[model samples]
Target chain A: MIKQILNDIDQNQAEIIAGLRKLIEMESSDGKATKAQEFVLKELKEMGFMTECFREDERSSSQVDYSPNRF
Target chain B: MNEVHLKWIIPPTDFEYHPEAYNVAGTIKGKGTVPSLMLFSHIDTEAENYFGKFENPYQSTIHDGKIIGLGASDDKGGVAMMLYAVKTLLKYVPQLPYDLCVMSILGKHGGGFGTLSALMKGYTGENSIYLHPAETGHGFAEIKNISLGVVDLDISVKGKPGKLHDDLSEGVNAAVLISYLVTYLEKYNQQMRDKNRFDFGSFKGEPSFILNVGTIEAKGGYGGINQRAKCCVRIRFYKPLTIEGVVEDLSKYLKECCEKEGKVNFADVIIERGSFRATPAQVETEDPFVQLIEKKITDVTGIHQFIHQYHGGSDIRLPMLYGKSHCVGIGPACALPQQNSGQMEWISIDDYINGVKILASILFEYCNFDQK
Candidate 1:
């Protein structure tokens, strides 16, 4: 069973490579994880995962750009 | 999002909170209402503000096959890959019998208050995964279930004030008393280090407990003898050692010092602030979660990832204790250069991308999406 699975993974190595490059290319850090999170939500929803995203309450947030920026 | 800042205190007070703090979470739903798999990453950088207006901290660039930026390796790498894994799994196999939730939390670097808030919002599961900054060679490393305990202590010493011209011996100087107290406490910590019997190895080869005097303040500088001196102390200890027990012992020690040293009152050594504690946690590798995760890691990476204790504490500890969850920390093999130095940090681009593939494979198998 493991051998079959490994073979299947080998066949789709290109997709995994491309997918990783795309993820690493997106830049989100600091209090800006929400930016990257929004991007994740889009991909998940596009791929049919029931998804929800929340921004920190502005009244409590310490950073400037806490609002969701849709792409 | 501006520059990085480090809060000496674990969870800063509301007044100290940055204006840009926020949290984001999403779920890949399962067939039933059973608690889903959980993944968490902190959003904030350590202290980028110290760097001033330099190049964009959020701008990520791939150089020499590495992703360089401020939060790239520390946590965003974890966040990016965790989310990407979910996307990949769903892309190849959409239906899942179990749910998976990914959270990019704020304030983890500060004091984990953002993750605390997320917990309040009900972000948890029976088994969870955490994204740590360091790498374990096995493609995935099962974090040691145990983390060290921490306590934030605020101590003040009071003594009789006297003028600089007055006899130094006659004056019950609070500064002098506090200094004496610090010396004694440091020696006590050293003694404990030498005699620590518990072999948890949280410190690897060193003692488990550490006492750090983070800050100190006196009413007057060295010029005059002040009546009061205050200091903030942080204590790190392993399990079976509670903060309350340490504070009790500390009070007794202070009282003894006062009696032996001068006319200063023992009651004057007040514990003004306390109650900040992060307790230690441990999970056995034989648990179902561990077995499943280990198998998945081996299947994906073709390597047996070792399950061992982690050195640092994280937000997952809270949920592990309260929610009765199994949380494992794993991440890309990337070096976090000057993580809080306000300098550019880096994560291996290949490692980051490969991590996604491994995690995706694990998710695909663990969630049994293909079985459906």
Candidate 2:
């Protein structure tokens, strides 16, 4: 089992790099990880897992544009 | 939301938070034999604050066998690793005796918002792994089981509000008075560093607590001094020091210093605390699940070490705090592509592949009740 798991990861080098690439390009910052989270949920669904998303709380526009100066 | 997190520390919330955003999680059910295992990492990062530092922060590039991007080493690598580990695990150990949960929570930007929400929503496991790279820059060679606490506050000195046309030196400049306090605080910070030293694997007598003055400004914007001269303060501390204790202690020292110096009116000095107060959390290294991960790490990469973290403010704290789980953090060999070369951070493709192997091994054995 150990060998199989290791071999599986080893053989999927291109796919691993591609996976990291996708996440890096998604740009999930400022509490906006929706795109990246969707991608991850899709991957898990492919793996046959029961996936779901937790919605964030509503925030004000000023709160969204928050920076150190505002604090 | 802003009340619970900081502008920078619990932070990452420094940027305006997106409304109606979601934290995604995946779970696989299993027989009621062993406790479940969870894989968690934040998906959000600080905004493109490094705007001019790198060529393209968003683009992932490869150089000398390293994958580089804005958040690659910071945590995107860990997020990818968790995804692939689960993908491979389902193929190798499809018959897990216990459940498996994988989460991509919003990270520091929300000031631990996503993780705290998940924990409150009762989405946790008996054994959890926070998939974040060790800030020590040691990658998978290190694992963090400790969550360092932090205190975030602002300290400022008030001055006479200058007129729009007032010359630069008309009023007792708040900026000038604040400068003296800043110098004193720097010295005091050094002393605190000396007192909070730690000796971990390959971390020989290093200061575990780092007190950083993240930002300082006069709010005058190239004009004369404004009504207040302020700076943001963050202290990452170890156990036995509560946030209130640190705040009260530091406040007292600063007040005494101002009184003794009599440079500026003592009343003018203002120390306003923020809401981002985080407490430390830890799970014993001797816990079977942690040892199992350490063993699998050795089994896969022939490298092992108990790398306790000196700074903390991430998803690593949630499981131990809310789930009562044995948690340890492990990630790829993530670091900067070059040392101070104005380049994006990176993670070794080899180390990343090896990390996948390690996580897969840990998952298989930890959930494989057949072994017991």
Candidate 3:
């Protein structure tokens, strides 16, 4: 039974690989202020998942950026 | 049919620097008797420069049975394997005994904001598998756990000006004086190394206490021009070495050195410290999860698995430290420790499939059969 299941997963591997390729093609970079977040949001929503977004406030941002002008 | 519900979290801009970073979570509810387990992997990858050779570093390519691409081995591979495992369990054995939560969080490389934010939103589970490279070929071995900590410090010193000509005793040269301090620290480092002082998993030696004099400045002199000198020092310490203890010891020695020189107006020495330690963890090599993974590998390719430790940090620390859960890292071997440079990085397709199978079997054994 486990072997059959493993085989089934193997059969579906191509689609999984394709999805991953699509995700990487988006070229998301950190702190770039790009649309990658929007892309992720749309992708998840289209896949029938609920989504939420959060951001750090001024106080928290300042605390996180604690290094003296060189972080 | 059993269904897995995935929750996609996208935080607002006010919560993080990269506000677009997202966490995709899917859950398979348990049948009442088993424990809940979370499988986590990051969705983000390191930034690439414009001059990078790869046309599209993110696009996956298969050449010579290796999956070549940015994020292919680092984490995207792990994410795909995790998602597939959960999906497989849901389809083939819907009534898993244990509750399962699979998540692909953001920022595994440097920005831990995604996982940190998720934790803030009250996402908790008892056990987790953090998927990163396990460097296949050494058999199926688990990371057992991780030691995540930080070391931050500053070291500075001041000295007076020396004579312009041949007056050997006029004053101390700030630059030269700072060099002496660096030499002293280096000597201490060598002693630590010789004594086998610091050891973290596979990485060993006392110089675990690393010192980097990142900055130095000096001004002021005796006769006409003023003279002074200062240096910024960074110290990295292994676990059990508190930052405060290191700073205090260095400060005491530095002050004594200044006093011995009889330099009243010498440069000021300043040192600061910061650190974080993840709780230690261990999983028996014979545990069901470990055994299941080993069985899958042997069955698939007739190779025995070996257990190993990771020398660096990973997102494994997040769950191990905060969730207080059992966490292990598993994946395919790409570049050897010292061989592959940046562009040459790649992972065999066979290894990738084998890793997925190992993860899938472990999930079924732990989340399905173990409880029964």
Candidate 4:
């Protein structure tokens, strides 16, 4: 049973690698990390995992930019 | 078939260094009579510019066999590895007895606010693995224990009113006195180093006790200068030492000095801040868990386990200090340059896979063993 699961993971290796690559490409910095984080949330949701995105202030969408100085 | 409920904890943005901070969480429920285990990693990294090494440090690159990026090693890699490990475990051991959780929390570097927040929200379990990069090298490196403590002290002295003159003895200089105190502290640090040179396998240094003056101030003009001056000092103590002992000893010495020289006066001292110490455990290297990991590594890479000590701090303290859980950090080695630039970092893909395998095996072993 474990071997079968390992085979399944191996078969999906490409997708997994692609997901990691996509996450890395998002360029998520400290304060300006929202867009990238949103991307991750979308990916998680697509992967059949329940996901939610929370804003620190809930009122300002622009404040999510990953910039240490702005925070 | 038991369905595992996985919840991703998205922490409030107000709690992060960036206006937008989050905690990513996923859970898998345990099978009959199995204990729950959490695998955690931090989603934050120290600013690239702190060490002034890279331009556009956030951009990740792949060169040779390495994944070069700001968090490729420090933690992002650990996060990725944990995610994959869970995926593999779920696929392979579908009905395992243990529950598993993976969290990429925020604010791990800035005093672990992310993990603390998660704990505050009541996310906990019996066993946990914090996926911070192992401090380089190969073999079985488990941080089963830690010495967590804080040092608090203020070094200050007063000088009589005076002006700059050729006769250096005429004016009592607070600045000079503070400078002397700084020198004494430096000497004390040297003494500590000489006494506790790094030995003990895998553990660094003989657990240090130190005094550092992070701030200084003085009152009254000296050397033809205007305005009264004062100084504030910061001290850090190593394991096996307490803040009370440090303060008491320093106070005693100060009193003795004042008695010898009636001119100098001691001011009120306070423990501006304090942090609790995480006690080290006496876990053996050949324990079942350790042996399990060793066998897994040998199976995968054909290399005997190499054990070493960590001379730094990490979120491992959270579970050890708060939850009393047996925790260890295992991950791929990061290729950090001699002088780190947030940009010039990397991890080997092969090592990353080995790390995942090792983590999965450890989890499986724990699941099979009953924690009474």
True-vs-predicted CA distance for residue B125, candidate 3, Å: 2.5
After superposing candidate 4, which stretches have Cα over 4 Å from the reference? Answer: A1-21, A31-71, B1-16, B136-144, B152-171, B187-201, B204-207, B210-239, B243-264, B268-271, B274-287, B303-305, B337-343
Candidate 2 yields a Cα-based lDDT of 0.72
DockQ order of candidates, best first? 2, 3, 1, 4
Query: DockQ of every model listed?
Result: 0.17, 0.39, 0.23, 0.14
TM-score of each: 0.77, 0.84, 0.72, 0.73
True contacts kept of each: 0.22, 0.68, 0.21, 0.14
Candidate number with greatest lDDT: 2
lDDT of 4 by residue, A1-71 (tens): 33444455556655555555555555555544455456545544443444433322332111111121221
Tell me which of candidates 3 and 4 scores higher on DockQ.
3
Task: Enumerate the chain B TM-scores of all models.
Answer: 0.81, 0.84, 0.72, 0.75
How many angstroms is residue B270 displaced in model 3 relative to the true structure, after the best TM-score fit? 2.2
Per-residue C-alpha lDDT of model 2 across residues B1-372, encoded as one tens digit per residue: 122221233322344557756778888888859888788887876566644565666788889998878778767788888888888888866778888888888775333456667776777888889887776677776768776777678878877854444555556778888887887688778887898765543345877677788888886766656677888788777666666567667766776777788876767776665546566667666667777888888898788555655446545666766666677888877765344365567888898888788888887887653322
**lDDT against true structure, model 3:** 0.54
Task: Give the better candidate number (1 or 2) by DockQ.
Answer: 2
On residues B1-372, what C-alpha lDDT tens digit does candidate 3 reach at each position? Answer: 001111112222332345454565555567756667877676666565532556666566778877777666656667766766666656677677776666666653233455545555655466677776764334244443443333344445544445563244875555566666666666655554464344533344324545666766655444433344556555544445443445555555655655676543223444432222122234444555555556666776666645545433355555655565655666666653224444634566677677777777777666544522
lDDT of each: 0.60, 0.72, 0.54, 0.53
TM-score of 3: 0.72
